[model samples]
Target: MTNDELQQLAAGLANCGKALLRMADVLMEKKEDAPAAAEQKEPEKKLTLEDVRRVAADKARQGHMEEVRQLIQKFGADKLSGVDAARYPAMMKELEAMGNDE
Candidate 1:
């Protein structure tokens, strides 16, 4: 191969390497920005009224009525279904913790 052709190929490779380095920098910036954006975002919950009731019914059917009643009383609700939406996640977590204990 001619020297001029080799020099052109070398230049092209250097340009490609610089382009890759710039792309890497852009990705690193996005990674740093992600946590800040995520912190500003409220965690999304997937629970529904039906889901709460269903999880409670499962508890009852499994002979966990005492635990269920305790949760209901703790939350000042008549039944699992009566628990407020905001408290449902906590309620479920308590129930889960109970299940985990045994």
Candidate 2:
């Protein structure tokens, strides 16, 4: 092949390499973002009084009754039932964490 033809072919190949690299970068970015997008799309499970009660019961059974009562009182409730429904998620989180402390 002529020198000029070979140079032109080299430049074309380099351009194609750059294009491929850009495509790879885009695909990688999308892959990295996929999990975050999925997490954002997935709705948080709604916490219920019963769910909180179940966890609290487990903690109590494990002999954390006093700790459970303090956690409930921290939310300004004397008992689990007295705590507002809106606070169930936070209450459950604390109850679950109580077991992890061990």
Candidate 3:
């Protein structure tokens, strides 16, 4: 190839190398951000019967037995065990709120 053609080919290769480097940098940034994004989107922990029972027991120990019974009745359950498992989250929120009321 002519000298001018060879120099132009080398320059083109350099440009291509720079472009690939920029793309690599961008990909690295995304790789670093992925974990944080996943952490933010993670689902909240699921509530369990024992979890609700623990909170209720705590409230009752704090002398809120009557309030606890009222909360259970509000959910259409005559007792804690009678309350549906699906209601555990709402029940936990109310139970936590009871502590905050103090």
- TM-score top scorer: 1
lDDT of 3 by residue, 1-102 (tens): 899999999999999999999999999999999999878866868888889999999999999999999999999999899999999999999999996855
**What lDDT would candidate 1 get against the real structure?**
0.84
Q: Candidate 2, residues 1-102: lDDT per residue as tens digits?
A: 999999999999999999999999999999999998888766778988888999898889999999999999999999889999988888787888896856
Q: Model 1, 1-102: lDDT tens per residue?
A: 999999999999999999999999999999999999988968766788887777777887888889889888899888766778888888877766666566
lDDT over C-alpha atoms for residue 78 of model 2: 90
TM-score of each: 0.67, 0.60, 0.64
Give me the candidate number with maximum lDDT.
3
Evaluate all candidate structures by whole-model CA lDDT and list the values in order: 0.84, 0.90, 0.93
TM-score winner between 2 and 3, please give it: 3
Q: Could you tell me which 10 consecutive residues in candidate 1 have the lowest summed lDDT?
A: 93-102
Write down the worst ten-residue block by lDDT for model 2.
36-45
Model 2 scores what on Cα lDDT? 0.90
